[model samples]
Target chain A: MRKQLPPEMLARDSRFVRTSIMDQILDPRNRKISERTIGPAKLAPGRPASADRARNLMHGIFTGEIQALEGAGRTAFDFDETEAPFALKLDMARQCWDEARHVEISIKLGEWMGTEIGEFTEATFLYEAACAPDPVLRLCGVNRALEGLAIDVFNTMKEFGDVSGDPVLEFCEDWMLADEVTHVKMGSDWLRRLTADDPERRERALDFQRTVDKLFSLGGFRGETEENPIHLARKMREMAGFSTTEIDEIAELSELARAEGQAAVEAAGSA
Target chain B: MSDPFKPRPAFAPWDRRELPGLFDVEESARRVGAYKWIETRLFEALGGWIATVPELDVKMILGRHCYHHAWHAELFDKRLPELREMNTDRLCAPANDAMEEFVEALREPDAPELTIEKLVGVFRVLIPRKIAAYTFHLNGTSRVTDAPTERSLEFILQDEWNDWREGEMLLQSLIDTPEELERAIRRQHELEAIVVRAGGITGLGTIGATTEVEGAGV
Candidate 1:
């Protein structure tokens, strides 16, 4: 391929019309749901604040997985054969297997939650991170950042499964969560090896990861605090070889993004 | 967590030693080893196809197939050591140079204009050959002593057939004209001849059912 596969053209027949992330953040409809919904701890399993909200989140997750599969698949295809070594491409190839399973699992989970594919509009932000030209950057963005976010989301959903007493949900999410951990580690290991001698390139990759981490945080979708929908899995991140410093940095970025998002909403309201 | 919901076995157990209908130990080892190589290569090749396939229906099927091949690889991977008592590294190589060439051809980074052509390559050509190869081994191997191997092949066989049927359906839908269908078939066969030369439609180096162990030289 001349370049990695381009971002997919999402189906126009999708049930829901996608809103820009900014519009999603500021939309009164979403704000109404967020305002009334209880925190993750207090929310019952099958009842995720509201059935509508639960369906929305589940559909987002379903689309995210489709993109996640594409992201990993592109990593395997988009790069020049020589640009990333065969071994690294092999790793990406293996990750595709895991991601595909996750897609199937996520689809089932969506059904269990009473959400259908295309029920919620997709945001391409996850795939945007996968578009990085450099292999190191792609690894950092897709594997580290996006898969890292998956860890948080899947863990949160797993917890919801546990509290909701939904055995299947808890069981399935746990399985998927395990794969995400390995994927993140794969990204980290490659990042280190690919840029072992070149500190500057490594720095650029790390910087790219920071930008993605910020985008993923998306005004408090993730954080260590109760306010966030998904909590950073410290133990899992450590298991995936993330240093404490990195986790702390992500937490800080989460807070910054949340504040910026809140400010944008306030400005839009005043206007 | 509660104990797993284990289902009771449905069939009677066979004797561990001298079971009827089992392949010779050497033959079992060779088949398991070949499947290991096939599955591993298939997993990677499917990955490449999943990335490039434009048709959503085809992409989704390839996505599932990728994971299915991975699971198949693991099954044979576990079975290989049991059959031969050898580490996977020693026995994990491709069935033959032809098999390796076919897999390598699948992985070329060169992007094609129409994913339909690639789809034809895999569904019409590659997977059918795999099904034939697996069917050959399944029919040839004894069902008694090599029960596990037989069962694994059976499971994989069903999936291979499903993939073949799905590909056939898609090909019928996409290649509208008789002339186009004929041309595509011709083109696919031409590409597959390379793989056929390496071995044949079965991906087996040998011509037919034989007692001689395949891939022994490799």
Candidate 2:
């Protein structure tokens, strides 16, 4: 079978709406909101809009889980034993089950937070990353970058759940967070093992991962700063087999993105 | 044949293990391999379809069933070696060209609108035959000597039944109009022919046969 199924082919019913990264970037509301906020747009418990913000973020998580399920399922189905090894495909299959559970959980969590399905727009970026032809590159883009982003997002949600005194949110987020960790670990192990012989190949995979990480950072959406909504999740990343240096590099990327976002808001304000 | 061994209750149907078995080591291994191959392809196909189906409820149902098929494949993997066979990779392939064509046909419906075709080929055609084949194997086998394979078959058969029921519900929901009913019926007929030509997922004369192959050890 041919590999690299395109993102446009992904099927969604009429209730769902699509948005692009450019749409987010060009939105005048973001620039105006950024102008008023002093640092990064941090999510906290006491803010008046925090509940809706959390609900919006939960909807995003629901969509992201669906894409993550698609990505892992594709990795399991798209590759042959010659390309991806039987053991790796089995891991991918296991990850698919995990993702499916996460999808269900995320849906319940969204309902608990008073949000409907398709309340937020979805970008097909995660599944797009899985469209890599090379299996190793797929591992890096999907397992590492996309799932690594999940670890951070889930952890952030768990903390939000904990701080907000929402037991159901806190408990479910923690459970799904654990699965995301295993998923990231699986990706990291497969990426390294598959690329051990070819440093150049490894570098290429790493570069692809960096590009995705930057892209998902979404001009400072994830970072170390107090302004960012999601943190780098350094401890969780380390548990998932990321080196200190790699984690630091992701932090640097997020910092650069945050600075760039702040500059954009200032530029728009002045203009 | 005065219904010998027939007096037991449903759960305790087999009280005597004295019979050697319906299948010896060689034929059992081959059929297990064939079952494994079919399960592997099924899980892979369902996994591929999860993202492309437009109906959210269908996607969620497929997500769960996809994992169930994957686990069924794993169960076959675990069962292979207990039959004195470590060469499962050798056995894990389509039983014949017709079987391969059957599975290939299963994955052919790619677009969102073709979800009915996809489900029809699987639940109506593939899974029912699998249930038949697996039951034939499990019931014919000696519960005394080959209980492991029998046990594996039991689990896989349960999953097949559950998955089949769920998929049927999906078909009933999606097939509202007469045209959709025709689509479902036509797709089911096409796939049934392929499986029938192949003699079932295991082989011809395997599932619905009145008698076993002439030389089986039983």
Candidate 3:
């Protein structure tokens, strides 16, 4: 019966305190951090501060899993069966459990890497994406875009685990990475099925997807190059039902976001 | 909500529908509607808790129990068209205002720290009544005339029973101390009064099978 529940109303224990993404963006340290890094921030094992960088990313993953669980639950509970198909809601419910497990896994992983639950601040963008009024839009934004970002992040972490010789991290990331791929595939299937007869609606959903993808790109944090910490998982994405063209489109979007972020950093430096 | 589901037969409104079954179409629709509404409320509430409950085991159980409710609601929804009423939404509603009030109280223990309260409300208060109602329906309805409804009940009861046991074990495990047991007991008594007053999901007469309210309201 609770419909259109806002992200602010999301229940969290005191330990799960959140920080606004806007605050992180506006922090003066971003300018210095961006300036200090000559190129895309490399997340390789040999890179400077790689361990701390991995911890931060791991903490982010932990928070992201919690938000993903919330997103899936909201999508399952918010819309009427008329708006969201029973099958889609079923999928959303399934995704809820998967994301919950991912949260537990990420929590343990965070501990293994010397991180606390909220050592790094949390963002509600994933939950915000789930708040879309339209079910298709919700699917596109949360399941495809946000969960798609999870695929990239998890893939990067898995690779980090493999290269860094951390079997626990690598195994856990690989396990969760498979779930993310399935979640994306579920979204992709629902997106096409729901919008089959309505091209305009499909376009709207895809547009919503693009907007969320850009939000998640987080400047150059996720991209195809080594400068980015999380590279787009094209092969994994293709397996998840995203076409090469869709992947290309996301890469293009990330490039634009990174360019704009660099410009903002430069402007901050001059000021 | 759309026609993405398999096509159902377009049953025309029956003329002078037979009364061989325990529940006539109007009464059947009312019961079915109430059941659908309750199942959906359960599903939505459980779905919400899957993310909020701090305990991982509770979250895991809720994640699965929530889907069973969703399926139960869908089964009721699918059964609606078989009756005289084509519009299932009108039929699908709370049995009475007190039932509505019960739902209001049922969903209040939503905070992360209120896992005990949440489990008490659901497993201790609501689900037991649900199983009893479904069992009553199974016993009262004519197997030949109301077979599909019975079929749905059979499927739903399996889940209801399993979820209740699982939830009960969880409730027991969480209650390590006397104060925890007291918390669970107090919460149960508080909601139990409301559910008892509301006459449970099917009301005082299970499936309205009694003579006092033939073709009465849901």
The better candidate by TM-score, 1 or 2, is 2
Model 3, B1-218: lDDT tens per residue? 67778876555455333437666678777888999999888877888776667675677578767777888988998899997768888888888767888888998775667899999999998999898888887776776688899899999999999999999999999999999988999999998887766777866675343444332234
Please report how far candidate 2 places residue B43 from its true position, in Å. Answer: 0.8
Question: Can you tell me which runs of candidate 3 are displaced by over 4 Å?
Answer: A37-40, B1-36, B49-61, B71-101, B108-117, B134-162, B165-190, B204-217
Q: Candidate 2, which CAPRI tier?
A: acceptable
TM-score of every candidate: 0.68, 0.91, 0.79
Question: Which one is best on DockQ?
Answer: 2
Q: Over the stretch B1-218, how does candidate 2's per-residue lDDT look in tens digits? A: 57877675645555555568778888888888888888888877877888888888788777778788778888887778887788778888887777888888888888889989989988899889889999998878888778888888888888888889989988998999999999999999898877767778887657647443322221
TM-score of 3: 0.79
User: Where is model 2 chain A poorest over a 10-residue stretch in terms of lDDT?
Assistant: A34-43
- Candidate 1 per-residue lDDT over residues A99-148, each given as its tens digit: 77777887888888887767767778887788788989999998898899
Off by over 4 Å in 2: A1-3, A29-32, A38-40, A263-271, B1-15, B208-218
Give candidate 1's chain B TM-score.
Answer: 0.77
Q: What residue pairs clash in candidate 1, if any at all?
A: A1-B109, A1-B111, A4-A78, A219-A258, B21-B142
Which 10 successive residues of model 1 chain B have the least lDDT summed?
Answer: B209-218
| Interface RMSD for each of the candidates | 4.5, 1.7, 2.8
Per-residue CA lDDT of model 2 for A40-74, tens digit only, reads 35677976578888889888888888887887777
Q: Tell me the chain A TM-score of model 1.
A: 0.90
